[model samples]
Structures are given as structure tokens and as C-alpha cells.
Target: MVNWNSLRDELEQAKQEGRYRPLTVWESRSGTWMTLNGRRLLQMSSNNYLGLTDHPDLKEAAIRAIEQYGVGSGSVRTITGTLDIHDRLEQELAQFKGTEAALVFQSGFTTNQGVLSSILGPDDVVISDELNHASIIDGIRLTKAHRKIFAHKDMDQLEAVLKESAGFKKRVVVTDGVFSMDGDIAPLPNIVELAEKYDAFVYVDDAHASGVLGKNGKGSTDHFGLHGRVHIQVGTLSKAVGAVGGYVACGQVLKDYLIHKARPFLFSTSQTPAVAATCLAAIQVLKQSDELIKKLWANASYFRSKVQELGFDTGGSETPIVPVIVGDPAKTMRFSDLLLEEGIFAQGIVYPTVAMDKGRVRFIVTAGHTQEDLDFALNALERAGKQLGLLG
Candidate 1:
């Protein structure tokens, strides 16, 4: 018999500990503002960096694609599901990243898992940054490779791991180009130099960096001018691209290898026609204009500065995703709840997502946010902070 009481007790325990994440149903399109539970709130926790999620061009492209190719791809890419739009999206992504070839997966998570698990084996080793995304962690777990994690972005520690991995048949170094929670960028140039010195391959998950860094938002590779230097690049279209799925940009040989060996690619259905077409359109938008990217950074800079000026501790953030550390889970939850009540929607980050004493309220600033919108949000935050005694 199933022990349902144990499950219920676990749920109660989680809620008491402030570890339970309840779903918020949005009644409107998730844009700069979110409509939830009959009220409109200024959205500050979304990943829609460039505000393209509700862009008319993307919506129209998706509609056109649906009318032409129907809703779903009907099968996996290796079978009869590869559409013209899929090939076009891959080509566009490769060109965007200046890579020899690119391959699309079901999502950013699956992309990391597939790439790592397929290429690595028992005799290989994976050296990762300690704060890399959970998807990367799971990807490493899937492989039989010996895993070595260095303190977050510690070049000295990374080199130590590389020195110890001399005997491994293959050494792969992986990192997130942008740390999502802290909004810090990985030192790709330094990582590349280390990889060259240690004869290891470099892989970076640029999910947060795409459309948010480099020249016209070309990502970390372009940001650091390390084109053709880094070996593997994985990114998500769901972020700034305002679409779905993820991609791997690499040399043609690796693409070919992934096509055959990556189980997620082999087993998963192809992306819907609408998703592919919409992503293609979004890429075109990215290439054609730097207006949105500039606005996004400007907004990020403004919001980060305002929050810091309010005496909030935004821990080492260099991007729009700023974390206001509250240090206590209950206080952080209270702050978030108060912000929600005041028509602002920023989620509280607690244990397991971060350390016990590092609970925070993470804010994501988007390009669509006008100065008025930002000021309004900041005012709400200030009032809430004072009321909750969070302001110093």
C-alpha cells in the first residue's frame, strides 16, 4: 500500500520551511507586466530579456507557420519530421554564432544533457564550474565520466583540476556563460586560454548570454572576441529569442556525431513548425536591430543602480538579473509577498536554489520596461522594503 500520509507530511514540512513554490497563473501574455489572480503586476522575474515574447512579428510568423505546416512536426528529426523551417533555423543560428554547423534540441536542458552524455564516457573527465546550472549538473550525472568542480570561476582551481586530469582519455570543461541567479558572466577568454594550455575542450551554456551580450547581442563568444576558439556553445531560444528550444553550435563533425549519438536528439520529437518559424523570425530581428538589446541593458543598468541606491545588496551582478539578498528565508518570502500585494511580481529565491543564508528576491529587467515602469517598480520596492524593515 502507498504511504500517502508521508507525502502529505512532506508537503506540510516544505511549506513550513518556505521551500514550496506555488504556481502563479497569468491571465495575460507575460510581458513587462503580468496579470495574475485578477490584478496586474509589474513583472520582474521573467527571462524575456528583449520583450519579444509578445512581439507582433513573432506572433505573425508563428501564425503563418501554423497555417503552412500545421502545429506539430509529427515525428523526430531523424525520421520524417525535419522541416524546411527547422533547417533554416539551424542555419541561421550557426551563422549567428559564426559556427560551422548547428543542431537544435527540444530545449536548453535537453541540449546540455544530450551533448554531455553522448560525447563523454567512463574514461573521460568533465571539469565544471561549481555554480553551473542544474541542467549541466544532471548532464554530468548521466555520463560515467569523473566529475571535478572548481569554486565558481576560480581559474587557479580549474587549472588544478586540469593538471589532475592528465590521465583521462578526454577532458571536457563546461560552464554557464552567464550565471542566471547572480547575473555574472563567466570569464570565457580565461577559460579558453586554460583549455588550450591543458589540451581540453571548452563547452559553454550561453542560455542567458544570447541576445544579451556581445556586439548586437552575439553572446559571450563575440563579447570576448573568442570566435572559432571555444569548442562547443549551447544556447536557448526561449530567452531573448522569444521562442522555444535550444541549440548547439560546433564544427560539422561534432554536429554529425551528435545527430547520431545524442539520445535526446534521436528520441525526442522535432520542435513544432510554429516554434521553428518564430525562432527564425526572432533571429532575424536580433540581427537586424540593436535597439532592443541596447534598451535592455540600459534598463538593467538603471534598475540595478536604483535598487543598490536603496541599500539593497545586489551581489556581484553585472547584468539585468539582480538578486537582492535578504539572508533569511522567511523575510525574503515576506518581501516577495508584499511586493506582489503592491502590484509587483518578483519571486523569492530560497534553499536548494541557493544556500541557506543566501535567500533573495531576484529581479529580471526587460527592454520593454519604460522608465515610468521602472520608476513605479522601484517605488513599490522601496515602500515594501521600508514596511518590512529590509531597507538599511
Candidate 2:
């Protein structure tokens, strides 16, 4: 029999270090407010930036898709799984992203893994931002390419690395469009400029920025007006799109190459028809108006300012994702638990996800939250902060 003692010991150590994560059960669809433990809590930890998960249009689209296509795409894209709706969704996504073509994947994680592993080889070099998402890091590890890391958003260090890696067969600079933990945007213009100068490929994972940035949320490339300059753009349909799956927007040649070579796309089943329909509807919804995006930003601004006024440290946030940094891991977890008791649901992020010295409770403000709801959460936070001596 396999030894279980080592796994048990690791679990015990995680618990002792305040890094043990428990699954949270929700009784309702995730929105600005959700049911947790039979209690209604203000959900400030969701990635539903535009609150489109429960939208009537999305629901109607999903229902229509189910009637026409039923559930599940029976096989992988290489075989019999590529539905007409899948093609339509890819066209819609490509148009929205202003790319020659787009290819949908199982998830944001797999998109990174498939794209990176398929494209890079032994003679290639990948320069990544230190704070890029875990998925990107894992994707890089799957490749045989030489890897280098630069300090988070440190353009000078990025340039230095680019200079050093000039002799590689292919040099790619990969970074997250928005840093999830710190809620800061990548310097895309600088990155693009440097990449152009150094003859490197610019790859941006715009997962968090997809529905929260740019003109009607066209993503970081459009947000920074660097359209067509960046080589690859990867984004998720789950976060702000209020659905599921991921996509990589690139030139037609690259899309064709990934279709033939990416293992995940070759082996895994395509997204469900309902999910494809939902994502298409989301893009249409975004094209129609910018009202939800505006409201989301407004809510984020209000919450961040108010929380900072309560003597909480919101570190370097420039978007709806706000992190209240508490240095000690145990105290950070305690603060999250206290907030939950006070009818708020913000998740505490600890070591491995973040540095041990930078444990924080991350809050994601959405368009669905009213001023009154935000005020209520703020009051609860104040009470919890005082109870835990986190405030003066």
C-alpha cells in the first residue's frame, strides 16, 4: 500500500502554518451576494466583475443552445466535437479581440499550458514576470526552453534579461495583463516597445483584464492602444464573461499551428454548447454597452477608498481587485473568518499563493453591488478590524 503518513504530515503542517484551505459551499449562483453556510453574505471575493452570470440574455442564450445542441461536446476538437456554435464563438472572440483568429480551450490554465508547451523548444528562451499567474509558471515548466524571471513590472530588469537572452532561437516575454494578487496592470506599452526593439514575442495573459479593461473591455491590448503589435493574447471566459473556458487570440497561422500541435486541444473535449453560447452572448452584451464596466469601476473605487480610510492597507491596487494586506498569515485568516461572521465573504490568501509576509484578504467589487450593500460590508469590516485590533 502507498504510504499516507507523508501526505498527512504535510496536511498537518499546512494547518499549523494557516495555509490549509477548506472548500466553501455556496447555495446560490455567485454574484455580489451569495448564500454561505445558510447565511446571506456580501460576496466581495468573486471574479464576476460585470455581474453577467445571472443576466437574462446569457440565460436565454444558454437555454436556446441546450435546446439545439444538448449538453457536452462529445469529443475533442480534433474529432467530432467541433460544433457550429464553437466556430461562431471563435469568430466572435476573434472579432472582439481584433485578431486574425481565435481558438477556445478547456480553461485559462490549459490554454497557457497548451500554447507554451506547443510553441517553445529547447533552444528558445522565456522571460517571465515574477508575479505572473501560477498557470503561466506551470506552463513554462512544461517546456524545454531556458527560463528567466524579472522582478514584477520592473521594465529595466526585463530589458536586461531580454539583452542577455538575445542569442536564443526564440525569446518570448510573457506576463499577466493584470497582476491578480496586487491588482496592478502590466506595463504593456513598455513591454511591447521593448519586445519590438529586442525582436522578442510579446505574450500577454489577459485573464483578469478581459472584461474589466479597454474600450468596452476589449482587454489590455486595446486598453493600451497596442493592437496588432502583441503576438499572443490569452483570456478567460469564466471571470468577467460570466461563463466558462479560455481562448487564445493570435494570427491565423499561430491558431492553425496550435490546433495541430497543442496536446490539450488535441486530447481534451471542447467546451459545452451552453458554455459557448453563454460566452458569445457575453461578448455581444459587452459590445452593446459599457454601463456594467463603468459601474464596476465606480464600485471598486468607492470600496477601496473607504477600506483604506478604515486604516486597512490596500496595496498597489489599480483595479476592482483589492487586497487588504495583513503581514501575518494566521491573523490574515482570522480577519477573513471575522469578516465572514460579520456577513462578509472575502477570502484570505496565504503563503504559496502569496508570500508569507504578504498574506491578504482579496476583495473583488462587482457592478451588481449597490452603494448600500458596500456600506454594510464596510461597517462589518470596521467592526471586525476593531475586534481583531487590526485598526487603531
Model 1 scores worst on lDDT over the 10 consecutive residues at: 17-26
Cα lDDT tens digits for candidate 2, 262-351: 998999999999999999999999999999999999999999999999999999998999999998999999999999888999999999
The deviation in Å at residue 362 for candidate 1 is: 0.5
C-alpha TM-score for every candidate: 0.98, 0.99
Cα lDDT of candidate 1 equals: 0.93
Question: What's the lDDT of the predicted structure labeled candidate 2?
Answer: 0.95
* Clash number for each model: 0, 0
Task: Tell me the spans in candidate 1 whose CA falls farther than 4 Å from its real position.
Answer: none
Question: What lDDT does the true structure give each of the candidates?
Answer: 0.93, 0.95
The total number of steric clashes, by the backbone 3 Å criterion, in model 2 comes to 0
RMSD of each: 0.9, 0.8
For model 1 the local lDDT of residue 86 reads 96
